[model samples]
Target: MGHFVIPVTGKPVDYVAQIFPKNNLIDHGVIVENAEVYRQANSDKIKVYG
Candidate 1:
């Protein structure tokens, strides 16, 4: 599995609030956000890695 990281400009509580509507848990939201950011930040990397 690949690893991804998302930089959120807020505390965990704040990020959890923003993520609740889109996911069931804070960790899931973080993963989703990280995946998106990773895709945007390194499309070429994904292409090569995948």
Candidate 2:
């Protein structure tokens, strides 16, 4: 099992959380102030800017 972190911007964090739950398989998302935090946490992270 792998981990993933998705930066939240523009859209509501709840909406993104709905799409990707905590215990789901294949996909997951999280909101962080900095993308580096995600990487530092040792999870794959994606940044969204808008």
Candidate 3:
């Protein structure tokens, strides 16, 4: 959630993969095009992992 791509912004973000580390919040809450990949236990309340 650091400085990164804004969906409404019409600018290109070339360093998206570097913006956030690979974590459950970004995995499940985002990437709406592929829901199945994000599906997993405790994804909704990710504090369980925190």
Candidate 4:
């Protein structure tokens, strides 16, 4: 799980955001923005999950 601090426009509240497992998977495991997009963009190299 990843944690992020988001700053609001005016409020003094501490807004936080959590990136889900699927979203975190991208650019991390495969270094791709999106699986399908990456696949369509790159056909020469096959996408494999580690």
Runs of candidate 1 exceeding 4 Å displacement: 3-7, 15-50
* Candidate 4 lDDT for residue 2: 77
In terms of lDDT, the best-performing candidate is 2
Off by over 4 Å in 3: 1-11, 22-25, 28-50
Q: Return the TM-score for each candidate structure.
A: 0.20, 0.26, 0.18, 0.17
Clashing pairs in 1: none
Best-fitting candidate, measured by TM-score?
2
lDDT of each: 0.33, 0.43, 0.28, 0.27
9-42 per-residue lDDT for model 1 (tens digits): 3333234344434643323223224333322232
Worst 10 residues of 2 by lDDT: 34-43
| 1-50: candidate 2 lDDT, tens digit per residue | 55565544455433444444454533445554433222223245544544
Give candidate 3's error at residue 1 in angstroms: 17
- State the displacement of the C-alpha of residue 41, model 1, in Å, after optimal TM-score superposition: 21
If the candidates were sorted by their lDDT against the true structure, best first, what order would they fall in? Answer: 2, 1, 3, 4
Q: After superposing candidate 2, which stretches have Cα over 4 Å from the reference? A: 1-7, 22-29, 32-50
Candidate 1 RMSD computed on C-alpha atoms after optimal superposition onto the true structure: 11.2
